[model samples]
Target: MARFFSRDRHGRRPLPSDGFDRALGIAHRWFLDRVGEVATIQYVTAPADMDWWRKDNTPPLISGGIGSSGQVALTLHRKFIELKYSDDGMLPERLYELLITEWAALTGKDVSEIDPEF
Candidate 1:
């Protein structure tokens, strides 16, 4: 089975600079580090409720959230990232950078780069 990691907060906040939660973050990352060694890590952008069906118009890669445009879900089987935004409040362009940074700290893997579009 695959392992997913997710963090949910209200609105937009700067990446890696989450205030206050940094205290527990240390322990959380440590746990992920160990888990990463034995399992695959699928970092999620938001908490998932397994509600992909919405209005019968949603795509497979997008998940439905309560009053949300939608949340992106990445699967390891994909070779690239396909971003489809419903709103202009797009996901930070630096998301891949954040992923690369976190991947190393949590997995001890030297992920120099990912699919550029990711």
Candidate 2:
């Protein structure tokens, strides 16, 4: 079972010491295995003070940004992940699909090639 940490003295939630790291590793390996070396997959947590206004109306939890190298940079918000996990409703498969879909778009790869079940 995954363990989550409570808010610290600063009243900010910190990611589980290993949960996000493990999830990111799994996601990286999944991308490498499914899509090969065409692009790099990275996970970033939203800063506590990040301005959502600049991000448009999209929920901060599942959004992607482009990198200097034209690679797809997926940012997964930790707060949202924790909320979903705590509710026992987190679906990693859904997140994977989102990432894979964005990757396909960015790399011009067929989404079916990355996830046949999509």
Candidate 3:
């Protein structure tokens, strides 16, 4: 099992992607039957500049992966923010949004509701 954390708007604390995947799996399955079980979630946060010297003799970067266990993880570095959801991949964007909105409604919160800083 992976650790989970709920993050408030300001993005102050980082929320584990693994937890998010698990939550999404349960919620989407119950609400839309769209989100499938997560097999892996990898996050690669890297700069757009320098070459990948270490990997291919390029620049500095962050890259990582997860497998099995339905995990969600994030890698944060400097330039990019990459979120890769494994478990058979996400449903269509429209369906994804509908799921999110429905979840918000169920929680008595508007889909647009988020911390101003977030």
Candidate 4:
């Protein structure tokens, strides 16, 4: 079985200095600390919903909310970061960075900002 994490919000804001990189670093490490011992991160993809038909057969990977344009609307479990773009050719790093930056600025908190652990 695999795990999925997601957050949803709406708004716009200005960018912060080094916010993306720092937020991503914190989120990545935080996720590892929480679920690393139990599950391993495999793939990170945009338009993740497209793969839902095959999710049952796939390995444990992180799936965030990616628009058809590849714009990341959310991150999943901090394992994989999403971006705001639409293309299979983009690198995960670029997506991750953009995701952290936008998400933080949008919500006024880090991308890793999660709800209660229940």
Best by lDDT: 2
Q: Give residue 66's error in model 1 in angstroms.
A: 27
Question: For every candidate structure, what is the RMSD over all alpha carbons to the true structure, in angstroms?
Answer: 17.0, 6.5, 15.3, 17.3
Instruction: Output the better candidate (3/4) by lDDT.
Output: 4
Q: Assess each prediction's global lDDT (C-alpha) against the native.
A: 0.34, 0.63, 0.40, 0.40
When summed lDDT is taken over every stretch of 10 residues in candidate 4, the lowest stretch is: 34-43
Q: Each prediction's TM-score against the native? A: 0.21, 0.58, 0.21, 0.23
What is the per-residue lDDT of model 4 for residues 40-66, given as tens digits with 9 covering 90 to 100?
222344344656545675432243444
Q: 1-118 in candidate 3: lDDT tens per residue?
A: 4466656658577655554345445544443342333322232345554454456653332333433542433232322211333332342332245444434443455555521221
Estimate the overall C-alpha local distance difference test score of candidate 2.
0.63
| Pairs with backbone N, CA or C atoms under 3 Å apart (clashes), candidate 4 | 69-85, 69-86, 70-85, 70-86, 71-83, 71-84, 71-85, 72-83, 72-84
lDDT of each residue in 15-87, candidate 2, tens digit only: 4555556565666677677876645454556566667645775445556667787766666676666555553
Off by over 4 Å in 4: 1-17, 37-118
Better of 1 and 2 by lDDT: 2
> Can you write out model 1's per-residue Cα lDDT over 2-114, one digit (the tens) per residue?
23333445665424543213322443354344434322324344335435534575534321112233232222211112244222122223333333445444435455432
How many angstroms is residue 105 displaced in model 1 relative to the true structure, after the best TM-score fit?
Answer: 1.5
How far does residue 43 in candidate 2 sit from its true spot (Å)? 3.3
Determine the backbone clash count of candidate 4.
Answer: 9
The parts of candidate 3 lying over 4 Å away from their true place are 1-91, 114-118
Residue pairs in clash, model 1? none
With a 3 Å backbone cut-off (N, CA, C), the pairs that clash in candidate 3 are 17-72, 18-72, 39-87, 51-58, 51-59, 52-58, 52-59, 53-57, 53-58, 53-59
* Native-to-model Cα distance after best TM-score fit, residue 78 in candidate 2, in Å: 2.2
